[model samples]
Target chain A: MADAAISVQGARKVYSTPGKPKRTAVSNVSIQVESGTIHGLLGPNGAGKTTTLKMLLGLVRPTGGTFEVLGMDSTRPSGRRRVGFLPEQPYFPVNLTARQAMRFYGSLGGVDAARIPERTTALLARVGLADAERTELSKFSRGMLQRLGIAQALLGDPEVVILDEPASGLDPVGQRDVRNLMLELRDRGVTVLLSSHQLSEVEAVCDQVTILNRGSVAAEGDINALLNVDGRTSVRAMNMAELPPQVVSVAEEIAVSGGMWVFSMPTEQTRAVVDAIDEAGGTIAAITPKRESLDDYFAALLAAHTEDVAS
Target chain B: MMKRIWPIATAVMMDSLRRKVVYVVLGFAALLVLAIPSLPDYGLGVESAVFREVALALSYVTGLVVVLSLAANRVPAELEKRTVYNVLAKGVSRWEYLVGTWLGILGVMAGAIVAFTAIEMVVGYFTYGELMWRLWEGALATWFEMGVVSAFAVAVSSVTGPVVVVTAALAALFIGHSRSTLLGGEGAMALRPFYPSLDAFNVVNPVAHGSGVPLVYMLSMVVVFVGFAGACLSVGVLLLSRRDL
Candidate 1:
């Protein structure tokens, strides 16, 4: 984590309204996003994901703890010069056209005045709003505004990008476009911190993930490390009428579909299981570690955390 | 900082142009100025002075309406709509945002005042057969006063909604111009020096009844505007910096 692109350590926020009880929105939540990788932040609503992001971007003042970007204090404006943020449900002045809005953001981001127009044109096209550059924002659909939000975030050529629900309100095709765009940014070595509710989206693009429940980190690690069941191997073999006796003895979870046998067995028994399938005149279609979908894992993790709190 | 402040200000100016309130108020005020000479109270020798007085009054009212319409809702609307996230996330300080918005409102006021004054002068020339150069002085004073008012409204709008911003702004305006009336007693005169009076920009008597305001007084008015606007915007920046957006 020494090369962490963004870090939030011991982050906490407390809200105290005059007539209401003080509420702790986040408590000691910490995250580390490494350089040049996509890190997914996942949580249920009110889990402090947005609050933590807000504190890191200087939009919300943290009651306690440290937030940093590239080793600089991100709570200050100067530290955010190299970082870009897209809030959930981004909005803009309805009177401005896409080009004018981009110019306004570019100037605030300290982009060179002479270069803003060129950047505006390229970024608008990059986000699929090339033809809508002159269209007023009031006429833009929700998806188009989201795209414009993304374009403005990149106006400064920021090294780090923080996106909250980046694919929200996008059509399926538009969501695919956003996914590809994120991959392109990654290929160019830009570090991205993504907070999303789309488990499938996170599962596809994230290198690592941190899940939160009730204002605290429920789990955190590399995606593969978290999702892969230890000491287990999954096998998908075709042209097998039935599992061999030896494979059957070791395999626990087994199923058959489309004339193919799928099962998971102890990692140590993979050689014997493969040999058994070979001996039975079956072809091994795939063999790898047993992995659970992010959806299942996220559900079980939150459930366990909730039960623990209730207990 | 001007690079940052300039765009926000221009955006505000651009936004104001789209709002119908600016055009509607100016249109009504211009028609009034054109009809000033036909008033039934026009005297034998003081027709030009009365016309100037009426024209200046129209200019002030027009500027006030335009300024309030722009300032009272710009920040609250930006915050409610969450458009400010784009600007502040780009390394622009909160103070820069406040000042930029204030300057933008001021820019729109400048345009409105100048346009209305031009209409007044045109009507005066055609009806009275003389140039009304003093109206420009009236326009300047009106613009400066509205600038201070816009700063207050923008500052208050930073943390509240439009209704509260407008109400508090109108109250501030009343207090600003009512210093002598509220503190006219002998004992109150001792506290007058410390009061936040906005009377410095009130040049109606000089511009309408006598020679134009002295050059020295105009210079001092600039100082008052700077002091008042700077103080209000500073308070706004402080409040906004603490509040979570």
Candidate 2:
């Protein structure tokens, strides 16, 4: 659609080295991320997720297909004027202080020289690096470097941002901060394409996800749609020390903790279970359609994909 | 264009300073230049000329070492460290990155050449009682030649690693300076124009033994620097554009 901020159509990449077999890093992978949304790129180690992102960002050459950001060819400098990227485990020249490094990147991002000082201050503060602004990068910790990478990617307030393993070396708090930052950017109408191995991080902020396996898109869609469990609903009840036998009869995946009973059942039997719980003097805390955790969904998706490839 | 290139160039220059290679080479060469007056085989009334020749040679080697140490590793190290991703991903063209890199190395070489020449001039003043201003011409020639060398290294490094880049760059230097000796045959004379040469930037003969390089020759070296550096960088940008980071 015209509204799609990033469109990768039939994207393919093949790496050729002398005296070795040609390796296909990405094949026929296409994804469309609409404006102002966070799209997660998911895959295993050799699944071409990073390669695809690299091709799109012009960091790697693509053997086939078209990649566009805001309808512009993102592989060119002019088209990338409004885009930003953070490489996996991003590194910078150790000789530069954090502020100077930001200035250098800000200039490359086409930010006004006069505005760089202010923008650098604000962005470093945003990423919690304000205190380390003048510290040379050689002295920065892994977590600090990752924060600086995020700060640099946000310079010039790019319309589109691509992040590869943005949380790779961060502690939990830093990862959370990055997630919050991505959400904040989305709220400001910035499009984000995040490539990450951290499934929980992806599940937390991604509106849509594209999973790759063996150099192709194995699955792609809204996060909820991909993980939703069909024909099932989850029920949570309170105040009853024990679940009534009638509710248990149809319930599956039942768990009791903190004096609350939680279970999933067939969607058709939701009414029967709710009625039974009501009769048993239990408070129906909530009832919602059940969805599988991303971890489980991803594992099964790959397992099924492996089977498909094998057979 | 300048906006992106200048920052990268400055960053390269700043980064180079922290690495001890430049100062170490410069210091060693300066000490050698200071000892140039003591060469015992100077001909009658040609002692200053000999000092100038040895000093000029020291300057050239010092410049090449500084240039090679920086250029040979700058691009490859950046690629290996993934530091270049930050710059290129910020919308700067690959050509800009290469040129900016060369500019930074050139900038450092210029600084080193001047500093080394200044030491030579001071030595010449104390030893022979004349400023020996001709060494500046030699320094300039070395600066331009090393600039071309750095460009070649940067271009080659776009597709390879530091070791290969250094090897290729040194080979280039050898070939660049050997066009006269290696292609002296009538059969090879036809290929002279096609072969890239570092001869234009070689003013050592006049700079070390005579009244120094002419103004016009000095201007032509700039032309040659532009032609050679531009060609090398164009090739580098082309190769880099196709590379996968």
lDDT of 1 by residue, A1-311 (tens): 54899999999999999999999999879899999999999999999999999999899999998999988999998899999888999999888899999998998899999999999999999999999999999999999999999999888789999999999999999899888888888898899999999999999999999998888899998999999999999999998778899998889878998998899999999888888888999999999999999999999999999999899
> Evaluated on chain B only, what are the TM-scores of all the candidate structures, in order?
0.98, 0.97
lDDT per residue, candidate 1, B33-141, as tens digits? Answer: 8788889967788899999998888888888888888898889888888899888889889999999999889998998898888888889899989898998998999
lDDT of model 1, residue A201: 94
Model 2 chain A: ten consecutive residues of lowest lDDT: A50-59
Q: What share of the true interface contacts does candidate 2 keep?
A: 0.93
Worst 10 residues of 2 chain B by lDDT: B30-39
Name the best candidate (by lDDT).
1
- Among the numbered candidates, top TM-score falls to 1
lDDT of 2 at A220: 96
Q: What are the lDDT scores of the predictions, listed in order?
A: 0.92, 0.90
